[model samples]
Target: MSRHPRLAAVAIATAALAVLAAGPVSAGEPTVSDPRIVAHFDFDAGQTPENIALEPDGSADLTFAFAHQVARVTRAGATTVLATLPAVANPQTPNIGAAITTGIARAHDGTLYVGYATGTAENGIWRIAPDGGAPEQIAQLPADAFPNGLALDERCGTLYTADSARGVVWRVPLDGDAPAVWATGAALRPTAALPFGANGLKIHDGAVWVSNTARGTLLRVPFAEDRTAGPIETRATGLEGVDDFAFTGHGDTVLAALNTPNKLELVRHDGTHKTVLTAADGLDNPTSVAVRAKTVHVPSAAYFDTTAPDPNLLLARISRNKL
Candidate 1:
């Protein structure tokens, strides 16, 4: 999902637009502290951790994209494979070009839901039990849909997914019903040059927030009382190559991962942002971010980095006052 040369082309085209959108909403510089590599994964083995879900005990569940595996990384730097999806015979998947596992969400009962983009019949959401066993396909999405970012709305008993190639948000009910399109608009679609659309998703404050990787913007879609989508709003822009993001537990503020730029930024409620971490802090194209209390969890897939690529989990302490 993260490209190097292609991303360079996108930067040339969108740089001026990003500067205009950036405006005067700068929140200063890096404020997060004590950033360190908590877990190291094998980059050559395709163990690129794409997304992360933090457990209550401080461990993290991740989707190893190219490896077709779901793993858990502990606070003490231990890694365990939780589930392995069936490998597709063909590697050249539609749109994004690989059969990989993208997003993951952990339910209250320890059920792990993940999005698999295989461009095949098994391209859907798979459920992994807490005890660990063969994963079950709970919802079958379209083969052409590249479901990337996933979020669980426990209150509504539903799961929301971002279709990176289709520019649509899909809603999957947990009651054995069917999955349906939740939202779609120009804002979620990708351009011809920039291939990825909706790259991240989250349910927060009675709304669903998503990042448009191609458009370099963050959008908010409110849920009506009946659980239908309200009007869409663009919360922030200029986040070129933004992948996945997490809230810092401070109202609507956010911590976003810039995939191509290899940086993490603290986005304020006023639409301004500032860099918090970079390659020097052990980020190799960070794909997603997760926050639990004061600890911040970030997984770098190293999808674009060619020289000295290191796919690992980087942890940092969230600044109580700065973030």
Candidate 2:
């Protein structure tokens, strides 16, 4: 389940309608097409997909949020459990209620790196090889920290994790070095109303781009020539409840998941954005998004879905039109 407090369903539905009604649709703007549910998960059994990473073969690797397991779903809707995380003696997680496996990233060699927030000694990042077995903890994050979004920069041999509770990003070296604080500031901090911050992490255009769920902003931390942190920049704003995002092949244009309202937005490079997908299109609190060539993948956890609880993955083709 998501860490943020759930808003009333009526409120979310109303907000979703407002956005959809105002969303712009014109020539040269990218819109979602052929949106369909590729996989339906057992929401009652804790199989909520919190994040996703795409495989080269059109399959998707997902972190089942409450199940504490990683699984793969093929294009034909076949499912396979890749690895199951160990159960914590005490399942109580800080800020959030229970332990969960959140963000995920797949390496070139088919290895999977995932964030596990057990709120116990086991809290950290875990790695699973291609020939999956037991996952090994590569980095031990703070027990109280909630590691949510993850991104891999194979160029720097680093794995960046967004700590939602700490409002900071951790730089975990793939070469076994200790994980250290990568970036933090006011923009990353949470609020009294929203408890989560730094919800998504991605390395794009030589910079680390992150979304702040509480602050409703997307920030950019450019890397210096020496690979140090450059001045922080706010790329987009007014994106409350935004979770994970992926860049379209068109430069810095992005497809971002707006969780609570069950919507997805096409965010342009100039900070302007418009809703492109909505609840009517089968989004049940979409948690993350991934773009693989012309394909867009969105996984809905349905954390706030009480009416007809159905946690599923939706796939759609990204319109070739340049935005």
Candidate 3:
């Protein structure tokens, strides 16, 4: 918007592009084989980035963990903090990061429905006006439940959230009725080894697909015409710490951000999957991904696993020219 902001965006993009020319990938990983880096950003480092929501205009609204804020990033790489969540002090928890703002979904009219870990229904989900006015509470959730990923079906007049703590999925009616547990099964709960069960939620085709971070698996449940959930079926496996993903808008292909291994995977509807990009190519704890045509936007939450709290936000052009 302003000269300084534009220049900052240019500088961040330039630095990322420079890395592609510098070498095959960053140190300590295999060389990038298939998809390569197109653009990246080390923006607002030290603040953990979580989920990203894409705007029709090619911009992305990203949620953070510690900063408790939502930032809008443009195609040109410029960024603006759209909203700051209410202060949530959760010293009793292992890390307050888990209790901060997480999932964010924007309505067609620009109303943004955001999720936070306030542990109170009145404070859990807040709808922020497009003009960025005070947030309005809309739904309630478990005090121990951690709602991380949000998916909105405006046509269905419902919003869905994935509770990572217990591997439960809550469906909230837009009409403001009490939230209902639309889907919850063994697939939704966390395993002993992997304590975080469901992480990301997405509605595609005829089902609501969910990613399990602990089990490193992806599962989906069929949704009937009346929004009834069917059986849970495994979609893909071997994605440990699979945080968030976005449809490539190309057939059944989807791009997923792998957190632990620091990779971007291309998974198809046929159950076939492949590693398209690696951290050696500059990905670091990528928490989530958003797509626009051939361009893929990934945010590295850079959790404690990373030396820094905030890593870089990555932009890459995949081999397949799809969103």
Candidate 4:
């Protein structure tokens, strides 16, 4: 059995999605002149990174998708265990090793937020102090909500997470309120064959953009001045397994990590335009991306081309040049 029960389902669709190549685009971030490998997974402390958050001081915090652990990697590539989250197991199907992502996000002040579940229940979000210690539960979620990707809206002092299983975007105020559904629509729902929907989310330029992993769509929902949600707009369509993405720090372009086909793609604000960096350039199952000092850092989950979990994790970097 694969680590994720859904991987079998992912296999069914991968063959189809993998072949839909992205055409060239002129408007977005320029292709990397040099793509380099910075860190290789030692697989000693943690395994399978689902997301990456970079600290201002150049350290990186990552979530182990199946291991249920939180770790930090320094610029020099040393790993440190921050906390081991409570295991989430399905009481009925205990033997299956599902890689449920406990989404990790870091605030500007260096604090971290994580989300996890014990199978169907005991699901919620946690706040870890800057110094890193035992996690304090911030809010519990619905029994069915599998929180995957997390984003912090600093202006509202709120934390938002993507519920991949239920196609919901949930929110919890930092000041103390129960986690509640922030936004949901047909766009967030998953396709029948592949399971993930509303996989990654971010608060950028007064709008929240979410990627529908199964449906392969990048969606946008405007955040009103009062923090209310506007209508959902299909910013980009036919994105094959679009996962986590980061602002390129150049004009209105972003670098998105595509999982199934194993590549990094540069996307424009219109979402219709794109250019990609493929396996020939050395990317494997890139889960998410973060930008700092004009550099794009990505963490590869290395989840594909094998039934058993792969221990080889990789961190790669790309330097963006101007148009």
**Local error of candidate 1 at 16, Å?**
7.3
Give candidate 2 regions above 4 Å deviation: 1-27
Return the top candidate by lDDT. Answer: 1
Span of ten consecutive residues with least summed lDDT in model 2: 13-22
Stretches of candidate 1 off by over 4 Å are: 1-17, 20-30
| Backbone clash count, each prediction separately | 0, 0, 4, 1
Q: What is the TM-score (0 to 1) of candidate 1?
A: 0.92
Residue-level lDDT of model 1, residues 1-323, one tens digit each, is 33422234444444433641343433433357899998889887889899999998999999998888999899999999999998788744456556889899999999999999877878889999989999899998887888899999987799999998788999999999999999989999887777678889999998999999888788999999889989889988888678899998878889999887888977777777778799999998899999988889999988777677789999999866532
- Residue-level lDDT tens digits of model 2 in 1-323: 33332322223333322222234554576667889998999987889899999999999999998888999999888999999998887754667657899999999999999999878888989999999999999998888788889999887799999988888889999999999988888888776656677889899999989998877778999999987778789998878578899998778888899888788988887778888889999999898999887789999998887677789999999976665
Clashing pairs in 1: none
> In candidate 4, where is summed lDDT lowest over 10 consecutive residues?
91-100
Candidate 1 positional error at 262, Å: 0.5
